[model samples]
Target: MLYKKECKISSEGFVIPDFDFDSADAVIPISTPSITQYEFDSFQLYLDLLDAMKHDKSSNFYPSILIKALKMFTASIISQKNNIPNELLESYDTPGTLLSLIDPNTDKTVFLEALHAAIAWTGAVKNNSAFSVPEFILFLIETSVYALSDPNFQYDRNIGNSTVALLRNILFHSNDAKFHFINNRGVELFSSLYLEVVGDTLKDYIIIVIINSLDVSPTPPFNFVKFVENPLLKSVFGYNLRSATSLEIRLALAYVKISPECALSFLNHIEIESSGIEFLFASTDTQVLLLELFEFLVTCSNETVVSIAEKKIQWNVFLPHIPMSFDSKLMKKTIQVAVNLFKIGHYKILDTLILKVLLEMMTIGNIKIKHRAMDAIRILINSGSPHSMDSIIGHNIISKICNFLESDRKDIFKFCFEMLLFIIQFALDGKCPRKVRDQLYEAEFEAIMEEVCGCELNEELANMADILKEKFDQLVAESETLEMAELENNHEIIEEEDYDDDEENEFHDNHFDNMNYYQQYAQNCMKGIEEEDESENESDDEEEDEWVDADEFPID
Candidate 1:
């Protein structure tokens, strides 16, 4: 029973001969007794080779030399049908076992050293072009993570430096065939290792490497094949892509290219909101990758995006993508996020988008989208924008204000009462659209009269009344001087005859405040002067003096 499958015969008709046991191979009976014994023996040799090579830097080739022999021998034994070792369920300290060489509890430092040596040995054995060795490499990768993660054995910090160097070679310097092996191996196995590691800080460095690998824009010579394309990678990535940290899918998304199917499937795989806003905004890579992902995400099915938002993403994540020239799919997503945000107490976002849409909403054709835009504008004014529109005070967005001012929502009209204050205080044009300005003026005048008459008022509405009173008093004072000058000219003859102290005192008493007094006195004096002039004309039998209406009457 050989768990390791034999390589297919190449075009060259070569079936490399196995050297461990003397029998033809059969794939299905991999866990038989002979196979079990053979695996145990190979494990023993593997540990023995690490033990022999530990202190010997003298022979530069010792690790490499040992690994080639080990690969050859293991290949031979596992290819046999009858002498294959059955699966052994043994603990770390079991005698003659691979785990015994790196037992975590006793002599922990020595155990990690032994495992590091094994990894170096694996790397040294591979030929420059050699790529996949499913069983051996998987065993090495999984074993390394297990050993490193064991609490009993603390990994040397020095080992990370060496590991980084090795990974750089595998990711950057290797041939195309080897590159696939390393990348596929990475995407397949790194997820579990990531979960086993502690803290997001360390995860950031790993994420950087993953992002760099996915950045194929300047086009690296080798194809950085997607994990979704390969069944092994898809199985492996899919299984652990949602492990207890962001490292899993964060990296998967960094590598996701143009496949809408992968994008849709991935949205379903993870709980998106688990990646916290604080954590995401904290990372430069996460931000960049998240943006790329949303660009891809919007293209996915509506059910998929909706489900993802229901689970993981926040509404704010979609807000930054809402400028005028975004994808229609993304706009739809924005609306969906807005709707959810609205349900949660973030209705302010709806207003902001609507104001933005009014500036650019002309191009959007969907009826629901337009209705949402219109409703948002009305909602915002009702919220606080109307009172505080001056605070937003001077945006060029003023161009879109007219349509909103005339909205049929009476709350809209009511809100504009305060909007007039914003315009008067801030408008560079002084004159906005005519109908709007006139209504604004009428609201101001009524508010002034209400205040002057000492009426009780709503808080904001009362404030506007005060502003209007101040403006109105200034206008009345200017009108008083004009009436007085005209009266002096018209009453010349009457002034010559006036001598009574009581009559003069009464005239002064009646006209105390300038604007109110002068307007009343001038009206009465003009009627008397007209009547005397009419009597003089009637006596002369001339009716022309009586023909004038109130329009002909002078202010004095």
Candidate 2:
């Protein structure tokens, strides 16, 4: 604290310690008339603060002190200009010492100023490179990122642009430093920004930014198959990953596009400790994102799918969130992904969760979600989970699938048929529930089969007829086998009754033969009479019987 007699200031007004400026070996005396040199000297203090910040980041002094220093130093530089244009100070690029006026306790004000200042500084440094733009931009971004306690930061244009620029820079330069930046701040800042601005009026711009971000390549980790384990990114974008609408999905797909490597990473992130879909899949806004994600996942390798199914259980998020919108583009992509995942044995990830969620959501979901849900459910029932077949079949998923076949939607009916076909195939492989299989054989499932058959028999529903026939035949065969077994058992019981002698046996055989002959004769007579009679002719012929015969002879 060695100061010249001229440098006099009370301890209370100076939040920054006197020792803080000691690092500036080239400090100019305060009495010097050259204010520019003083500004530069004070600017040196800013550098010392940066150094100090790097070492000890305790928030002892509120951000107001930093704001005050910026105001005082920048003002000192601006005032020295003899005649400054007022517009220059108020321009979008230079809001001028406004940062100093902010009260640190008022975080919203500080946040806005800090955001504006960082943006303005970036532009200012680029326009006027008497200072280093990269270094200054980094510092400003660093400061703004630190001031994230305020949720309102994302709404400002300056903040939005700066945040996008920072991300762009990181994506363009996929070096260690930038990667770490994205890995650390990418999820929190970017996701928070998205959350704040998701449904806001300027969502168009935000979505465009996301689209651009996803377009970055060669995707994270240089491969699209590895699971990314970043907590912050997962926390923020996981829900968005399953958005019901196209916009949120488009944004999520952006991350996957740049780094196909992110596909497994994201799936891993969403995987919960236990099985069950999160409420996010229930969100009407993001389920479409989940569908798109699965579509992307299908493009991944087999080993990737296998690894995901083994460790992850989050596919349930997609179960409840079927997108009914039927974007041919998205649907095409989704069907491909689902097929691939099934081929690779990822169906176990869905299992009972798919059936449970779909059953609850089918009637209640939007047309689009419902449609997508039906598509996924059908695929699931048919795919057959090798590891979890018992769980799937044990839950009565087959009955529900049969019910979906009766939906009025032709697309749904066709999907249900395809599903039934798959179910038959899987059953042949012995994957169906034991109880359900027995019911199919016992003719007990006929009512449901009849309804499904009716749906398939329509000329317009011919596409589903083959599958319906296959299921029907399988069920009928099972029923007939049971019936034959029952009949055999009854015949054995009748034969068990013994006769005392040969003569008694002979009488029993004659009796049985006569009864059989009479039954045949009676059956033939009944058949002929039914064929010959007609409603009109029978009414005319029987009219006499109905009248005279009853009136004249009934009493006798």
Candidate 3:
């Protein structure tokens, strides 16, 4: 009795030929045992031929000559229904002998023919289930992984990749095979092999195996592919249309889904520099998905998990994708990541670009995105990366945010005042408030703050505004105190405010220290961030230089 053969792994699913020996017709019971034995003796010659060729390939003529003969003769063992594979399996060592021939030194043609025979033996469907022979299946996988691991071993990609597909098929179809695979850290060997192996077929198979394994949390024993595998972080990031399918972006998503901890393990300072940020430049779906992964990593509530994600995923990397998150439609995940970046409080990322997106989001009628955009802007101020709004921090911004102060959207009014306070704070702190002070006066900043003081808003918002209104009056009075005295006292103050000058990152940490609730909202999304960090500290080594080829991308 084979287990459920319907796996939604690929378009053409695998038929798991896991036969139960308890079933009546598990194997054809040969009535004449000696007759079967006599026929089995003949197929032993094929195995012997492989063994002898392995010992001496001096007659290179003969072994190359025997490649087809070996494939046909060995194929007959299962294809002819001669009971040879059955009799051979009864003895433990025989199966290993057939598999042991899969070697780096073996002729590619002869080795593939032997692998074909192994597949037939393992995949033989009617009675003899290949799954029942775990010893042989495991051996074949172990050998194939070794042969494929050889860096110097190069073959025609079609042949090489066909070898990968044939081996992948055995695992593709059987749960028992997959169990042996994951536990043995088959991912470690194969991910390394992926860098060395040629052929889109093999690359495609490995990517599927990885996505299938990491995408879903399998039950015990199969749960963590990370236990031994590297997930080939370096290679996946460096991929181009010339090297692999664009599905690498999907691989990044599956990888992040593993756990925040798992993400940081390979997402090192080095790895992050290589590829994670580039996904924003790919297709829109890819950009949105990549943002979703960043949202998960940055928003995890677990302090340790959050720490790992934040350090590796640099905030400065996301400037390009931020605007798309504020698109006319609700790109909820993209905004979530943008919101997270604000919460993390990196001033390098919270620049004029974000201000533009925020202002645009406010005017759009898309209620869903508008609210999130509002939340993001409020978080940005509350996060205190206010210097970014300095370039255009004047009457236009003051008037726009003040206009929303009347919005009934549950005190989008509260943030309207807060956004104003930040502009005021920058004016005073950057020591260059004349322009902003004038804009606030032009926008009736005092009257608006005075009115907000009377509105039914939260105590924090009210108190924060009350403190700010007084500051606004002082700001206006300071501007008028004496333009000549102000200029004379702080002549260089205006030029000192350039963010790109010598004092760039120098100001970020200082501003973040003032943020009222910088990381407070990130924890709110913790429930959505999955916890698959079963082994956080497992180490992965770097892979060798890539074996390049293959132009096809996987279909969605």
Best by TM-score: 3
Cα lDDT, model 3, residue 87: 50
- Per-residue alpha-carbon lDDT of candidate 1 for residues 226-253, written as tens digits (9 for 90 to 100): 4423442244334432232334345556
What's model 2's lDDT at 353?
59
What would the TM-score be for candidate 3 when compared with the true structure? 0.41
Mind giving the per-residue lDDT tens digits that candidate 2 earns over 1-556?
A: 2222232233422111122211212111221122344564454465345334334536777456655544444333323322333444344333223323222334553444343333224322322322223443344335434433365544433444434433332333234334343444343454455445433423433333334434433354433222223432354355433333455455556555554345555665654333225424434434445455544554455557536644554555444444344334433444455545555565554443545655555555557656765666555555555553455456656676666655777776666566656655555554443355664444344575566666535665674565567665775466566669889998877666543366688988999999999999999999888867766687888886767555556564
Against the true structure, candidate 1 reaches a TM-score of 0.31
- Alpha carbon lDDT at 464, candidate 3: 75
TM-score of each: 0.31, 0.39, 0.41
User: What are the per-residue Cα lDDT tens digits for candidate 3 across 1-556?
Assistant: 2221221223322222323322322221111112233444567666566556655667848656566445544444433443446554563343354455555466765565555555455444333244325565455455656555655656533334434444444554556655666555556666676667665545656555545444333542323455322446555454541232445556666665566555555455225543345644555555565556656665655556566666665544554355545444335655566677676664434433555556666665377677777787677666554455653462256766766665666557566666667777777675667888777667776676666677776777767777777778777776777587877667567567554554766566566664535555555455334332322322211222243345555557
Give the lowest summed-lDDT range of ten residues in model 3.
Answer: 26-35
Better of 2 and 3 by lDDT: 3
Better of 1 and 3 by lDDT: 3
Q: What count of clashes does model 3 give?
A: 1
| lDDT-sorted candidate list, best first | 3, 2, 1
Q: After superposition, how far is residue 456 of candidate 3 from its true place, in Å?
A: 18
Q: Score each candidate by Cα lDDT.
A: 0.42, 0.46, 0.54
10 residues in a row with least lDDT, candidate 2: 13-22
